[model samples]
Target: MDFGPFLLLASLEGLVQAAVLSLTALGLCLTFGVMRVVNVSHGEFYMLGAVIAWWAASILGPKYALSGYLIALFLAPCIVGLLALASERFVLRSLNYEPEATIVATIGILYIIQQTVLMSFGPDAKPVNPPFYFRIDFPWFGYSGYKLFVIGAAIVVLSGTWYVLARTRVGLIMRATQLDRDMAQAFGIPIKRVYAYVFAAGAMYAALAAVLIVPIRQAHYLMGADPLLMSFIVVIIGGLGSVRGAIVAAVLIGMSDGIISMFFSPTLAKMVSTLLVALVLVFRPQGLFGVKTS
Candidate 1:
């Protein structure tokens, strides 16, 4: 294959990665942006989604693979979202939503979820088969049809998220709460309830991303670590609470990761990304889109 075709193929792969990363990071951004909580358990939610997807598929695939896969796609996020809401209500809310305390609480939640999965599902990595098999023939090679679907699905989901946050009453309420919790409360905005919903929504986004990508990548108990790290990187680089920045930064990081991993090494790709994040933090602590606070 020519270098140009090779590059194009790499870029396509990168776009898919960027799509998934954007969704994952957007979740983190939403939670932190609204609740001011650093959810250490966010990645575990991703893992749980994927694992649940695999479980759902396994149970249903024998008789109806396509239907089962579709059902898994729909159910995983809802289940994860509800679980997240419970955590927010019972754990974080009870803690008074303190940033440091919430972080510790989420870390504890992380281990709890991880160990529970380990005990129930064992340590094996499980694979969920794709619902359909087709490829788009490129000049140099064929690309996965399913991957293209993932890219398109992610775009739709992200767009819908934008619409809800930008154009809806609930979004306005969430924004109001984010801007000034005390003032919003004074207006009887039910800030705690908004926090619970935002927290759930964040986890739902993460779960949706996980479901979209789990077929390409097998479900594993330990899979949450990398997504968590990359989400943090994207959030930090894009600026905390900045949805636009997360999307832009996700593309940059995802493309770089794909191209570099294809041409060189995954380790090198990660090293470069980490270095870039460090530089961003050193020079722009508020992040690319983050407003400086007094």
Candidate 2:
């Protein structure tokens, strides 16, 4: 009954899990806040990003592993974002003013993208090994450098996003559009353009998370589904359209999942997390940091 070591491991695992959730949810928050689209296939972008990393690493050889990672880190998001933009422009735009039709259209896009990926890459898992340096560990808690990197990277990216959103002009426009699309438009903001940019940005965020996580978890076509669900839950728990809420909720969920999965079974851990989300929905439907909408 060595709870000490188990607890330590669980905490680390939870943090990793939370980091992944935050990555995915950030995308959801961005798009949902601006475009009001759920983008169900968002998880597929992670799968695609990871696949891109794997393919690049394999095709380019060890000398190019770092290059491949770098490429995936940049290219994956751009590809997904562009795809989302095209979809929005051609498909979603046509379904304007019809929320239900638009949702269904996005779902169709998700399946099409998923199946197309499967056709191209098959259904097997593909690995993307981290660089050699990541194998080393720090003195404290035997935490691998790679895990630390993931945590640190998540913090830096999220922090940078926070700074930009809080300080930048585009960020202000995005916020304004999120709060009131019509008013923002009335003030000369191009509502359609905002929707396109935010959707692309959201997809890019999701892809970035995908590339980051691929080093830890092998890539597979279906890899994004669980993350997608978990992220939605994180977004729900944190309060919709609140970046601060997403961060807070991500850390909490990460810690909770890590600790619970360590002591109990993973299935039990999932059940507990879902139950927590349900409770939040029932009691504080607005979310921990979500502002109430009139």
Best by TM-score: 1
Q: Which stretches of candidate 2 lie over 4 Å from their true place?
A: 135-141
Encode model 1's per-residue lDDT on 163-265: one tens digit a residue.
Answer: 9989999989989998899999999998878999999999998999999999999999999999999999999999988888898989888888888889998
Candidate 2, 97-179: lDDT as tens digits = 26688778877887888899899889898888785454454344456677778887888999899988999999999999988
**Poorly placed runs, candidate 1 (over 4 Å):** none
Q: TM-scores across all candidates?
A: 0.97, 0.94
Error of 2 at 16 (Å): 1.7
TM-score of 1: 0.97
- By TM-score, how accurate is candidate 2? 0.94
Can you give the lDDT of residue 180 in candidate 1?
A: 91
- Residue 78 displacement in candidate 2 (angstroms): 1.1
Model 2 residue pairs with clashes? 14-258
lDDT for model 2: 0.82
Mark the 10 consecutive residues where model 2 has the least summed lDDT: 132-141
